[model samples]
Target: MYLTSSRPDIVHTTCLCARYQAKPTENYLKEVKMIFCYLWGTINTGLWYTKDSGFELTGFSNAYYAGCKDTFKSTSDGAQFLGEKLVIWSSKKQDCTALSTAEA
Candidate 1:
């Protein structure tokens, strides 16, 4: 949750991993380790909001049909920006299953 504020790229994978916390396996551990490795490699990269940027707000969203391997639920993600600065983002599994890409 903490990392999500600054690292939107990890949101979906992290959220997916979080869902298996109650019954984590070796694969899950490996995935977590991979995230740590990625963080280590990109320690110097980070978000930087500038005051000179425009004030326009923009947003984008997408859904992956049946993205969850375990539950066959779709995953939805979105990001919002204030001008050129990113202000909000989210990645989550949908509450209901999507039967097709269009539905997703």
Candidate 2:
């Protein structure tokens, strides 16, 4: 969960694995290992911001209705940016069930 703040790319996969934390199977462990491997391979990768860049804030959001088969809950995700640099992001299951994408 902590890592997701800086590495948004792993948010979905990590959250999926997190759902199985109570009774993690081999597959869950494998998926976590894969995330670690990916991190190791991209240790030097990161976003950069230039001092002279334009100042702008932008946001994007999306949701999937009834995405979780176990709970029939929707998943919503969003990201915020300052110019070309990502400043915030999040991905989580919704509290209430969503019948459609718009509801989500």
Candidate 3:
């Protein structure tokens, strides 16, 4: 669970699995392993702090209409960075259903 602090990308997935930490089932364990595999595959993309880099903050975001097939809800995600390192990020389903793509 502590891994979520520095690895925002896996926060939601980790949190879901954490809910069953007391008596996790085989499915939950499989999910946890997948998370670790994902981390390993993206090892080089990790944030690294280094001296001499300028402290410039930047953010990017995107939303797609009806992106989630299961809920038919718009999904949005964002990432914030400080110089070369990511400081924050999030992905979530919107609360309201959109009437059209424009509304989403």
TM-scores of the candidates are 0.93, 0.90, 0.60
In candidate 1, stretches whose alpha carbon ends up further than 4 angstroms from where it belongs are none
Q: lDDT: which is higher, 2 or 3?
A: 2
Order of models, best TM-score first: 1, 2, 3
Candidate 2's error at 33, in angstroms?
1.2
Q: Candidate 2 on 1-104: residue-level lDDT in tens?
A: 88887788899889988998999999889999999999999998877778876679999999978988889999988999888888888899899998777889
Residue 54 in model 3: lDDT: 67
Query: In terms of lDDT, which candidate is strongest?
Result: 1
Once fitted onto the true fold, the runs of candidate 3 whose alpha carbons sit more than 4 angstroms away are: 9-33, 40-45
- RMSD of candidate 2 to the truth, in angstroms, is 1.3
Query: lDDT (CA) for every model shown?
Result: 0.92, 0.89, 0.80
Model 3 lDDT-worst window of ten = 11-20
Q: Mind giving the per-residue lDDT tens digits that candidate 1 earns over 16-37? A: 8999999999999899999999
Clashing pairs in 2: none
